[model samples]
Target: MKKVAFVVAAAMTCVATGAQAVDPHVAVGSAQYSIGISGFVPVICRATVDATVVPTQPGQVSLGSLNEFCNNPNGYEVYADYSPNLGKASLLVDGQKVPLGNAGSTRISKSNRAGIVARSVTLDLPQDVQSGSISFRVVTL
Candidate 1:
């Protein structure tokens, strides 16, 4: 009887341990983005996230809200956009395709074509991301 009660208590405690979404430990240079100079125009940029900060699951990576900060030594205000539609942006660890996630391209960029135009989206990671080395791709729509 005591063992049964202890088992129940342990199970309850495990269930009570709610999960908190943790911010990803980003790789040193995992940056992928596309530049949209005009409506639907695109200039794609792709880079791999640092191997050190691997995703616990596929969804651990993500892109978030863009912000403005001081980047220039001369007091130039630099801007970061989560939306891939803009001219410049950062592709976060979370690069998914929701209302605010990565956009899957119906087509690939053409060699003849120099650009594309579309609304830029942010990056997203899976709720159950995998750990270890991972690859990320950033392209223009």
Candidate 2:
């Protein structure tokens, strides 16, 4: 009878409990942008190229992945975190940019304050962005 009671209790517990799932979690409130670039052209590294941003209202970049999009009332921020395989890398926003000389497999993140209006980005990149899935921007530039 004791064994029967324990089995019953276990079954009951199982019925009362819910299943758990392993879901990818982001922080309380955070967003991200990830891009993949290939086919690097070192010659293009020194030239300034424009990377444009498209507006996504209440949107996040590359959902289900590391990158995300969001719409906040307290002003919006755009970030481009890049990992390039070749050449020098520099990030430009409006007019301010930072240059990184001779880097490999590196991630550099830049934040620019923005609003609902889409804006233009200038880049003096080391290697021309080859090819990769982008969480933000047009992705295919």
Candidate 3:
């Protein structure tokens, strides 16, 4: 009698444990449900400088033009990174003058705008210094 009772109790426990485990595929009910979606856009910018060099002032050298394009909706900014060899350089962007010491970045645009546009970039360097390279950068604002 005791053996039969122990076997019955063990079988009941196994059944209870199996019932406690829930299956992921089991559906609660058939009803309407909602789904979510998302998306993103990356910032893009490009710049090109003309090779044509035209001398303006005594120490100032003006390049042909700088073409820039940015996809940012808010606006964009232009910066001039001068090389270490340059001494006392300044930039003339659309007739606006921005002074930059030997090396570092300086903002050349007075009013930030988006899309493609061409502006004049001139370099005002010391008379002794000649033949130097400067890079331009565009960033979204």
Candidate 4:
């Protein structure tokens, strides 16, 4: 019958090329995964000062002496910013004002994490600290 219809049309073209090589477009899908994270406490902190300028004679003027550091594990305080002719200066370490000054900062060392907590400050010159010119600075509040 015409060579059996050319062998049934070449066996239906080899079964349609083996059904397109079996891939058949089956991409069964499902996908989902996630991750996200985030940080800051960085106001670290630092301060240092050391003084001993000698040229004394009015009441033995001596407004000099300090050494400080604050790494801030959440603890720090030591301030003395003066230049108003030092008419109102009072900051001690082993005499008074351990934590008793507001506008001039007098809370010297209390909280510490040991990163940079070194202190040795003394400058109580208030007898009208005079000598012609003056300046001071040691802060980390």
Best by TM-score: 3
RMSD of each: 25.8, 18.6, 12.8, 18.6
lDDT of 3 by residue, 17-121 (tens): 454444333333234222334568787887678954444344767776888888788888877776665546677778887887755677666335568889987
TM-score-best of 2 and 4? 2
Best-first order by lDDT: 3, 4, 2, 1
Assess each prediction's global lDDT (C-alpha) against the native. Answer: 0.31, 0.34, 0.69, 0.47
Evaluate residue 4 in candidate 3 and report its C-alpha lDDT on the 0 to 100 scale. Answer: 100
**lDDT: the better of candidates 1 and 4:** 4
Span of ten consecutive residues with least summed lDDT in model 4? 26-35
lDDT of 3: 0.69
Q: Give the candidate number with the greatest lDDT.
A: 3
Q: What TM-score goes with each of the models?
A: 0.19, 0.29, 0.59, 0.24
What digit string (tens of lDDT, one per residue) describes model 1 on residues 24-72? 3222222432222324523334322223342333332333232222222
Worst 10 residues of 1 by lDDT: 19-28
Clash totals for all models, in order?
35, 8, 0, 0
Clashing residue pairs in candidate 4 are none
* Candidates 3 and 4 compared by TM-score, better number: 3
As for TM-score, the candidate ahead, 1 or 3, is 3
The CA root-mean-square deviation of candidate 4, after full C-alpha superposition on the true structure, stands at 18.6
Where model 1 places Cα greater than 4 Å from the true spot, the runs are 1-52, 55-60, 63-123, 136-141
The clash tally of candidate 4 reads: 0
